[model samples]
Target: MDVRFRYSDHLVGLIEDAAVAATRIATAPVSSLAAEALRAKRDAGRLSARLDASPLDDATADAVDAGSWARPAEERWLDEAAGEGWLGEPAGRRLDEALGGRVTGEPAGDAAAAQPADGWATALKLDGMPTQQVAAVEYANLLACYDAESELTDQLFEAPMTVLTTLHGLICRGLVAAEILGRPRRTIQAVHDGAQGRVIFNTPDPRVVPRLLDGLVDWLGATGPAGSAGLPTLVVAGVVHERLLEWQPFEAGNGRLARAAARLVLRARGLDPAAVAVPERTLAADPGGYHNEVAATVHRRGDLGPWLEW
Candidate 1:
């Protein structure tokens, strides 16, 4: 990826509010949407490269051009690519072995024994990594991640709570850890307190997650009508994003869930309804900036200005 501006650069120096920026983007000329499709393909390629997966091919790009996203053929190609991305070649091999030495038809939680490492390089190529299996549920999860994008366009416009439920539900749909699937810890829990514990960078306490989430969602118009904030959809998406990250409602898939949730806000508001912005690639392209800004924003007061600027 080319060098891009940091979160603080404010390189565009747009003085408009997030709302205006969103409108400007949403109303972009139809001619430009073709270009947008191209960029989306480019982004998918970057994301695949970052994840040590194969780049999406020209036909996949043509799929986007033909509006085949979330379609069966598109899903088969893209979802499998995403599955490959989530589990690089090595982890895929480990998972392949654990799936009774194949990639398909494994039982759920079969790879429950595999403990993904802590932090960003969780399952990329490394020597003698412990997690060496793919559970049936994890395979379900891979398929679900691709399938959910199709659902987002319709659901993102529903009630905020509905949207919230959808986000968690999607993340939980094919969870490898059957234990934590669709359930938030009722008792107190900490990311750093378990055998899987590692510095999560930052996450609110389990006790406070509900409270903070309640407050944030209400402000976000989740329980009420959305777009009440009057902010640009982009800004709203950013806020939804940061709040989801800070709250960390789920034991796993929080980052993936948050990214999808943010995209939901955009899709609901017609900012990126085609699901082509590929913000995940943006973050993947600059993991350092993402980590730094996520820490900086949450550590201080709930100021979203810096992240929005980025």
Candidate 2:
């Protein structure tokens, strides 16, 4: 059996659904925060364009590469809050630590981490293998999509799916590097696993996939402004994510796609989607409970309060 075809079919369904949702949301009203976020996004876009057009000095390039365009506004806001004593000292300290020594620069040790930090290098030596190459390819693809100006309908499904593929690929590579999975077994198992599942959410009929996705897109676009007002963009994004996950749309990778969709919504809201301010990681800490929450929602076909609250 050709597992590639199965994987492709599953992904096609998922992509179609996502594309439809994005289209709906694209026409929705822009929330106040979304407006602010749009401005920031525009600024970042302009900066990126300028960088691409003209070469910069190493220092300047380094700063931009460190994501300065995205950092300054948030950093300043946090600094002001801390300066006013609005943020507790401990909280400020923790933030600083997480951000590394410089609030405006790349996190501390990222450079070293990129090139085998001391302990990591020692581990590699002991294992008699090369240092782990953190998957830069995935990051590159994400950055490319972020920089693109295409409409949601044009790239929605592709962007998120690319991210998912990159994520899984990175995970597999990391596992192999750690000697948890040998190369040959990795190749065979990944192919088999990717191809085997046909568990699509909501409807089994492939034809419904495109229509469902389009409905979501229309809904999102229509409600964009109104949705932005009553709820924080992050919360709205979370809602959308949960809804899609419940709908399932694809046989495999629904969870990953939902998470990616959440990230996209966050970006649309003008926030760093990857920022870990929310305790989402905490929910993932208990894997079984997390799955149960999702299962409950799927079974009940109603409120996802449990999952959302977590």
Best by lDDT: 1
For every candidate structure, what is the RMSD over all alpha carbons to the true structure, in angstroms?
11.7, 19.1
lDDT of each: 0.48, 0.36
lDDT of 2 by residue, 9-32 (tens): 444454455455445555555674
Q: In candidate 1, residue 307 scores what lDDT?
A: 76
Give TM-scores for every candidate, taking all chains together and pairing residue i with residue i.
Answer: 0.55, 0.36
List runs of model 1 lying over 4 Å from the truth.
Answer: 1-143, 153-158, 186-200, 222-228
lDDT by residue (tens digit), candidate 1, 1-310:
0111234436234424444655666677877876775566445433532332223344544444455533323112223433543234654354334323323211123122322323223212223322211122222332355445555455444445444544454344433233343334333323331224455355654545555545554575543344335555666677777766656665565655676677767777776665556776668766556656767776656667777776
Q: Which ten residues in a row have the lowest lDDT in candidate 1?
A: 129-138
Q: After superposition, how far is residue 222 of candidate 2 from its true place, in Å?
A: 1.2
Worst lDDT window (10 residues) for model 2? Answer: 182-191
Clashes of 1: 3
What lDDT is obtained when candidate 1 is compared to the true structure? Answer: 0.48
Q: In model 1, what are the clashing residue pairs, if there are any? A: 18-232, 19-232, 95-134
Q: Give candidate 2 regions above 4 Å deviation.
A: 1-205, 224-230, 250-252, 271-280
